[model samples]
Target: MYQLTLGQRAQPTSPCGTSTDLRGGPIPAQPAHPTRTASSPARVGRRRCRPPPTDGYEGRLVGSGLSGCRGGGGGRGGDGSDCIDALGRLLTRILRHMASELNLEMRTDGYVRVRDLLKLNLQTFAKIPLKSHTVDEIKEAVRRDNKQRFGLLEEDGELLIRANQGHTVTTVTSESLLKPILSADEVSVCVHGTYRKNLDSILHQGLKRMARLHVHFSSGLPTDGGVISGMRQSVNILIYLDVSKALQDGMKLYISDNKVILTEGFDGIVPVKSPISRRHLSPSSIREAKP
Candidate 1:
């Protein structure tokens, strides 16, 4: 914001000018210092010694023209104290803009992912004047706000955030939703009551047999013994079919890892990999699998 100024221009002079005529003559010498008179005893006590008058009296008295002249070291303003304050205000404005953008995005999305939201939040926090609060404190504040705005809640003790009336998405806690299905010693068929009913059915059944059925619930799924494989941990599975009827109906069992679970409602079945067949099937085997 600082600008430079130009000095006044000099008029053209004659080629041969005489002193005291067109050309300027040398000025008489002036007193180097202001003469001081003898002072009364009371004034003498408060009087300060002055520096010797010299050609560069102003420069000497002012010390270096740099900002270090005052008690403060050289700063952004060169010699004035205004620069630091101006810089602080500029930084505050930039950070405020960034914070505003982040808040807008969060509002539009209803629920922002933890990882994605941290970048902007961290930037704003870093610019805070006080160093007493840490990045973690800022993150906690953001998390609390997000939870309040989006109805975020913990699923299986893990953070699972969602917007109000938002579709329930699958997460690492989905496995907890399978407790009801697994608890039944008898084969139980599960179904998604939401969208894509057929697709959900096939996926759930196939994923279940392959030990891939994972469901997430508001309350954690039960993990009692005798639960089916793929139903003990976090998974996206929505429906479970009670295929125990197939075994009781005298169907010849050709169990293998490649076997797929099929329900009467679905036209086709999905492929899945099961760790154990009927001969060695147990809740422990399914529980041990990695979701």
Candidate 2:
């Protein structure tokens, strides 16, 4: 976990400021680039954040920093859409992976005060400062997000934000971060999505929670009305779980604020069972895995 010194007393010792590596080592300075003449406006725009990889957890973290952009060219705040997109990605990273690392005390349910989040001396890859971001911009990011990945609230007089699910931090527990589905009848459909390439491994070894606290499931299919989070839009393979059976067997399951179904699984693995079924995205296709 990288701890970038927060609070007013910390001063920048480098081009942006003193930033530590993930291991807390001093990051080396980069070589100087040729300066552009004033007549030629720098054409750099904010670096677009990358999407999560197909294999999901095995993939490296994406969407960490904004790439430097300037003027009408790519740069932080230069393009309205680009700025919001970058901001959304950054928010996701902090709320999902770096709350503890950055020392922004998060609630057990995973919310962090928007004011506290704004205090961090965030920067783009081009060293563009991000501390100027306003609370309204943060609200816009949440409103525009397609996945409904973030949840926002007004506690007393302060605004708070949190990733709806997909947490990797040890500090957040399933009991704290999620709403339990006490009755098996509460969940009509619980499906996990994945790429067809991972199908064989999943069938053989069952679904592992990977680096996350629980295996994520969707209440419905992508095309199903009211379905938003949980499964990715691009997944071709869906694994249907017997939530009732799992519940009857004493396994626990939960639902996040964004409606994602979750379970730690029995010993962290959802074994193949007779009630569990596999289906392609196509409506006509359905099959059961061998128990």
Candidate 3:
């Protein structure tokens, strides 16, 4: 059984229909995993769960507000923190990468039925099974997510959930997943955060989407009041983009529902204009900083 433990929050919604695949066909029923009834003996003597290996993923729980977890019960923190964290990571993977592989019907706009998602037999590092997760628990997890990585929608009485951005599925078109920024003024400031180690390559080759679908940018600095998500707090380098310039150059820029600035980066390469090498500076400092 896969254990349930806290994992790195990964860096990175919709409506409609009776849980159908991208091709609009009904999803095959997933075989159910055996369940432990309330009378079952509790498994004990298991070692305390450890932090998951860093996968370069980013994001943080906004708060420890989860009241309970259904699968395997208590987490490492003994307060459902582990279970919620694990659930969030699992949701990210399935929604962003494995929808096709798992045969879970993901719509073109990147939404999957909440009921369909809860049917998978996945588990956490603590051996907590995901099948036991309640819709309320899943809802709570997404709500408390600091990055606002997921968006929830209710349609025709069915709950739908989706990742706001950072999708690898090519069929999930930007036109479907993101809202187009029609004017540069739609976003006041656009900045891409990175590390010093990547500065040289980025300065020369520009920022690439790498494995993800779009290059992410923030509308403001992490310290800025308007900033919610998009950039990680640990990034030491900040590359500010001229939104107007990019727009004028015929670049397509988009903003996720969570307020993340995203773009294809002018054919997978967003040429860097100037990179600021510090993180503590204010939003206005980017304008004053020299290359």
**Highest lDDT among the candidates is held by which one?**
3
lDDT of 1 at 132: 26
Residues 1-291, candidate 2, lDDT per residue (tens digit)?
011110011112333323443212234433334575654322222232232112211112123222222211133223344555656767887787778878889988888899898777665333333465667768877988988899998989889999888887777788888999988678767877666567668756788887677888888766677888887555556666766678787888999988899988888888763333322224323222211
lDDT of 1 at 274: 32
**Candidate 1 segments whose C-alpha is farther than 4 A from its true place:** 1-182, 185-189, 193-240, 243-291
Tens digits of lDDT, candidate 3, 1-291: 011111111111122222433212223333233576774432211122233332311123225433335335335435566667767767777787778877889888999999998777666543456666678888977977888889999999999999988887775889899999989779877777776567678766778897678988887767676688887665556676767767887888999998999988667777754433333444445444422
Each candidate structure's TM-score, on Cα atoms with residue i matched to residue i, is 0.17, 0.69, 0.71
Give the per-residue Cα lDDT of candidate 1 at 38: 46
Residue range 1-291, candidate 1, lDDT tens digits: 001111111122333323231111221222233343443111001011222112221232144332212222123224322222322222222221232433423332223333333233221111122222223332333343311212344445444323321112322122222112223243332222111223334333542222221221111122424322222132222332233433443322221111112221212232332332222213334222221
Rank candidates, lDDT, best first: 3, 2, 1
By TM-score, the candidates rank as 3, 2, 1
Q: Root-mean-square deviation of each candidate, in angstroms?
A: 34.1, 14.3, 13.2
Better of 2 and 3 by TM-score: 3
Cα displacement (angstroms), candidate 1, residue 65, comes to 52
TM-score of candidate 3 to 2 decimals:
0.71
